[model samples]
Target chain A: MNIRELILNPDNFFKDLSSKESSLTTPFLIVLALSVLNSIYTYYETSIIFNLFPPDMQSKMSIIMIFSIVSSFIGGFISWLLIAGVMHLISMAFKGEGPFKRTLGFIGYGFLPNLIGSLITILVGYYFLSNAQVPTLTMEQLQNPTVAEEVISSIIPKTMVYTNLLINIAVILWNLGLWTYGIKYARDLELKKAFIVALIPVVLFLIYQIYGVIKML
Target chain B: MKKLLIFILFLFFLLLINPINAVEFTGIDYKNEYLEPGKTYDLWVIITPEKEINNTVIGVSPYGVGSEYIQIIKGRDYEGNLLQSEKGVGHFIIHIKEDAPSKDYNILAYCNYTKDGKKYSDNRIFEIPIRGKPTLTVENPSVINEGINRIYIKIKNKGTGIAQNIKIKFEEGNNIYALSEGYIKYLKPGKTGTVEIKVYGENSGIAKLPYTLTYSNPYNDLQLVDKRETESRKSKTITYNYKNQKTVEESGNLIFKIIPNDAIDLNVKDCSFPVGKVNNFTLSIKNNYKDSKFTVIIGKYYIGNNQKTLSINYGEIKNITFNIKVEEMGVKEIPVRIIFGGNEIERNISVNIIGKVDLVLTGVNVEGITEKTITGDLSNIGTDKAKSVLISVKKTERVIPLRPYENYFIGTLNPDDYGSFELHAKVINETDSIPIVIQYRDENNNLIKIEKNISIKNLINPNQSQENNDYIPLIIGILFIVGVLFLLYWNFFKKNKKIIIKNNKNNREV
Candidate 1:
């Protein structure tokens, strides 16, 4: 389904998608595109954090950034599968019937909003990081908790974090709505059960995100 | 037998007549036994009268042996009344001619009187000796200008007698002075005797020294002759030439040319000093006369051998140096006195004292949270103005200089004046102070640098624990995030829930 149909008419889009046989091509392509964007965002953020490290340590950060970008790229697809698998398991408890492949495909389509969100977040983050006043730190200074905390806060300001948070919440809510309809149609479950199934993981992820934001303060 | 009787009776009558004479010659006395030419003497004749006589006369006259040289001016004859047994005295004035012969002479004393209308006469003779006159002349008189000069004055006896105990008294002039009088023991006829005189002169020009020459005359007594006299024995003038001895002339009174003690011109060639510090002062002097010794005095108080001795020759220039310390600033005039050739010359040397510049930091203010900017006022507390003032932050292990304001230029600061400066630096952790360098030029264009430590204790870092209390931005960010979350849930979740209910109702109605 097109991005407009997926966003504006998620119920009809998911209903029409469940009628076709499950294919991994379109869903994998969407997930791969989102993973690439996520990897790019991750590379940008990792580079900023690595800049605070000492010169000798910064050389090693390049390798760590490569691994982190790879993990982020792989984690995007894994997260889509994990969300689908978890939702399918929860739907089964509600006496739902659905194949795992269809659930996975529908969950991957739900990540379109995340793809757009990552692009917007990268743009916003690029603006902030480009103009940010970053403090140079030695290994010894970086070890100091107060200096590290201040450095982190300076690099990622409260406004940028909050803005990113609002954007993430909006994207997550849209994904949740799409995922609820996708789960209901793909697993042949009732709307309430599908909504409950999708809301559980999303609510847990939201709580985790809120806890990180609070910890940053 | 009659002729013998008559001679006897005549002798008896002569004795009787001598006893009855009006006046009888007794003796002749002269005041000066030795007569000199061109001089006068006094002579007296005495007579005794046995009876009173009227119109009795007494007289004295030169008779034999060089008598032509002496002339009796008065008492040639005397007419007066004489009493019995009274001594009649006759006074005579005699003058010896300038060309008189030096020999013995005799004079006659006679008395004539009338007794009982008849005339009778009595006479006596005395011898007198004449002495030669003395004439003096000065010769070979000379003087010099350096120090105490010994003037050799040759006194010649031009007369035919001996000049004894000759004394030459020197009179001081405007530029010449006599240290001692000149003296000669004896000078015979046609003989010359030298007298030494000590004198000094103050200037290099013609000078006259008037003197009086005193010597014993032909009678072995003192006689004085000054420059005013026209005789050959009068004191002569000795003219001396300081630069050229050939110019000396023996004319008029005692005249001499002298080289001035102040003939040397003193000039301050170069004077350099700093206030409150010892420095060398130099004086250049040019001597215009003969070689002479000089005592040079620079200032009132001696710093380092202010009094110096120099021996300079004619047409020579010499430099003298003195170490002096001046405590006050600006131009100062020092008096210099040169003592030479028994004279002193005073001069003034102008010395300009350059003041020292003392630039100090008055107040400092450290600004900015992370990147510190130091702003402070610099004051010139010394006696001079400081120019091209610059303030810079010194980089250390913990202090790093920042751009744009790492160094500040303050232009100029006068004495007792101040200027402001600003410098930027980054002080690392636990560094409570940073070093700053202040540099400027004095009035003499000497570059001076001063290093001072500025305390950075007041510099607050944003990462500090105290600054962590400022959580307003974090709180605002959290509140905004929460509001956005609420709005997202209300718009998306509630709308989705209503749509789901509507769909479920549609399914139930179908």
Candidate 2:
């Protein structure tokens, strides 16, 4: 199925895909593309935050950028595997049957929305960081957790944080929708069971995002 | 018989001599009994005969002690005949020389007459006294037209005798009045004696003083003379010049000029000034003279020109201003001396200096709890101006000064003027008050400091209470999160339930 059909008629597309041979190649390419977008967004966001470090630590920003990009690239695939594993295990409770490879492939496709969200967040963050006045801190000040938290929070604009939170919530809901149909079709589970399986992680992730927005306020 | 014949012959001889002596001097009449030197007098001699006589001639001539100084005129001797029981008159014109001494002199009167065909001659001597006359004059008569003026009138004796018991009586005039009379007991010839006459004049002008002088005449006191002329008393009217009437009446003295009561009126117009500031002091002066110059001095300050001269026109009122900075508080009297026409009038002007500067804080507002910043108004309530005003947070046990606004500087504050000041401090412990210090300089450059405590009991700390209790944004955030979640459920699960149920029914029917 094309990207338009997968996004518009995800239930029918995933059900038709589940009936065919489940190949990991397209799913792997999708996950790799999402990971590459996540890494680019993380690298940009981390580079802006690195300005809060002292001059000596800021000189090592290249190393910090590489590490953060590699971790976010790897973390994107791990998050896909974790979501598929969690959904498959929860589907088993309802006596749902699904191959682990098919569940993982469906979960990798769920991250396509995250790639768009990351691109939008990176654009918004660039605008925010361009205008933000970040206060430089000493090593001793950075050691203090409270001082570090205050400095970080002050540098991050509240509007950017709220906007990113709303974008993330929308993206998470879209992924949940795709994952609901993907799990229902690939695991051969009831629609209610798949929705229940999707709602848990989405609700928890939304709670976390709302708590950060409230804390920022 | 021989004794009777001799007695008859003696009696007959005595009787014949008696007829010859019958034409003796009965009395001498002269114009003056006392003859003064360089003067002429007429003397009349009367002679009587016992029987009728014809061709009687009588002549009088000076013959005694001072007769050398007396001369009888040749053509003025009387020559006439005498009758029985009638008197013959002899008139002589005598002149005393300029070098005559003052003494008594005798004049002889001789008469030749024929009685019963026989020529009889008789001579008699009359005494003439010479004495001096006293002439009095006044010298330098002048007076001041003020209260009681003591005028010294020099009484000069311009005669050849001693004048004694001289009494002078002053007559009142139109402008000048006599307060008392004058007396000089004795005055020698060509000598001058001063008599003090007390007088007062109501105005300034020439005053005519008519006076009568009475002195004892030594020549009249020594002998009785025929009353011809009296030279013992003199009457004269003297003119005395009066000046400075207004000056004398106003100041009661003559050492100063005539300054009218309204000539220069001085008044302290404004004295409400501060202690240390250079302020303008106004003095109102009204001039009543015809464009006169005056020097005004207040305390140690001189107004106007280099010599402190101020020229003002007639009936002109001017306000004189000078700078004054008083150091003390209270009502002070500043000595003022106004000098005009070489005279000085001293006066005292009271200046109420009021009080000094006092600063108080109002509308004090404190912000943070740990780091507090106080802002309020500082005012000067006194009459003085305060300069270089500074307000700072005082360091205490529980309060410490902070940065940015530890001390606020306010340049100046006048009387009843106020300025805003802000101070920042760090509060260590919970306290109800924050200490602050205010410093300023007075007009005299005296530094003054005041300490006060600002209450912070009613102030709310935004960092603590405001941040914690502000839940409106948090509630909105929660509501937004719940709405997003409901939308997600309805759009992904609730709305797709019909499609899912239809798919399920198609699968079951197949």
Candidate 3:
């Protein structure tokens, strides 16, 4: 499916893609491309995110950036296979039939919303955080949780953080809607069954992201 | 009647001719009249008679003046007959007591004898004086020079009495000649006087200038008025002890000390040179006397100058350099003789000629963790050049050197030239410093090894955060995000009309 069709009507896009046999390379490449874009945004985000952290923790930016790249590339491939396997099993339980490759390709294409959302989030982060000042922290100051939180809040603009978080949550919901249609068409299953299959990992990931944000705050 | 006249005439003539009728008092004398307190003296009384005498008696007395000072032994009362016409002599032993006052006393002696049926008597008197003994001391004895040395002699009269008319005389030995008789006219008690006399000596040795002093006791003149007065004389010999009488030699108090240029431990700092190579050795000459000048003679082969004139102060040390070369590989001792003011002292120092190479490590910096590089400047601190210079990190039980590239070959390092090298090493927990070994070849192609240790404690334990990598959780979060994206793509993006149906035994795509 073309980018326009995938963006405007992801359900028909998945339906058109299901007629042809899916290649693992294309799905793998698609996931890798999206993951690489996401990792690039993360690399810059990590640099800004750690600006509110202490200096000692900030030096881990390089290691963290490298891990983002490696994990996204390798983790993308592994997750594609895992998602396809899980969906095929779920659809089979519901008396639905589809090739695992087609399901994987359809799931891979479903990353369109996230890819677009991450680009918008990066742009928004740059706009708000361009002139923002990083806070200076010491090991002693960071050890005291109250002082660390106070310092981080003072340094990171509240509007910028809130705006970035809202954009990320809105983009995630949009991707979930697209994922439900894409799964139904790709797996030849009911909308509810396809929704459960896509929502499980997304909910789990949302909970994890919220947990990391809380811990950092 | 004629015969009776003849007998009377003959007897009168015999009386006139008989020496017994001429029994006259001679004189009284003592062996030592100037007697010291608490000493003895022998007093002799003599008389002459013409004829034989019987029952003769000689008596001596101090006339009550010396009765307490002098104790004279008396003659017996029943003395036998004395010889006729022989000079009659009597000896009296007299002892002067310790409590006797220092003064002169008169001594009297009397003699009674019968000759030709006639009796005669005579008396003699003399005086004796008691005084303190005189002491003569020689002061400022000096060395006697060759050929008539005018030695200035000083004598001190350390006594209560005057040394009257003290005449000193030096003995002329085989090796010495006296030009003037040493004499002192008079010296009052507790007074010192100097008398210079000329003497000669042929050699440089401790020569004994034996001298005698003859002095008369000034109080020896008798205080008696009736008897004869005389003086008592005494003689004493004195020897002078003068050490450090260093006679003339070719080099006087000039000492030589030969050493290498480094003037440290003689054995360790000995200079070395390759065969036929020139090197420098330092020779120091010291004068141990006050204000002395000397000409030191070291041959031209050892040093450039045959002789050097050095005017050094007392205990002054001076140094000179000797440029010497030798052909054979052996140790040679060079003797340096220093001469000054007729005296000399010699010293010998050795120079070694053999192949040698020594390495010194400087400016060492070892940094990093287990995989660390040992970087330092290696210098050749020996007299010879080191070839095939190799610097390596030696492995020990606590340290393991990296394989394949552990050593650096520097090729050659001359004396005092420095080169830098680096080697990789890994240290275990037990190791604190790693030993950097340097191996090289000497001029004779002999392998020499040197090792230096560099501490890595500060390098390894840098003042940084020792925290474990926190990227594991971040990696997990990233994987989860990627997993979610993959799932969304699997469920919604791609379309598949034909679905594979799976039965209990077979699965088919329709």
Identify the candidate with maximal lDDT: 1
Q: Rate the local accuracy (lDDT) of all candidates.
A: 0.74, 0.71, 0.62
Please give each candidate's TM-score. Answer: 0.40, 0.38, 0.29
Among all windows of ten consecutive residues in candidate 2 chain B, which has the lowest summed lDDT? B245-254
Q: Which candidate achieves the best DockQ against the true structure? A: 1
**What does candidate 2's lDDT look like per residue over A1-217, in tens digits?**
4787677667777878888898888778888888888888887778767866778887687897898899989998888888888888988988888789999888777777787677767676665555555555556656777656655665664555666776777788788888888889878988889989887777877798898788876
Instruction: Kindly report which residue stretches of model 2 are placed more than 4 angstroms away from their true locations once superposed.
Output: A1-4, A19-70, A88-101, A116-170, A196-217, B1-445, B448-510
Best by TM-score: 1
Q: Write the per-residue lDDT of candidate 2 for residues B201-236, one digit (tens) a residue.
A: 555444565666777665453233223333445834
> Which sections of candidate 1 miss by over 4 Å?
B1-510
Give RMSD to native, each candidate.
31.2, 30.6, 26.2
Displacement of residue B20 (Cα, Å) in model 1 is 99
Query: What order do candidates take by lDDT, descending?
Result: 1, 2, 3
Model 1 per-residue lDDT at A207: 89
lDDT of 3: 0.62
lDDT of 3 by residue, A18-81 (tens): 7776766655667777777767766775676575555567667668778876776677568667
DockQ, computed on Cα atoms, for candidate 3: 0.02
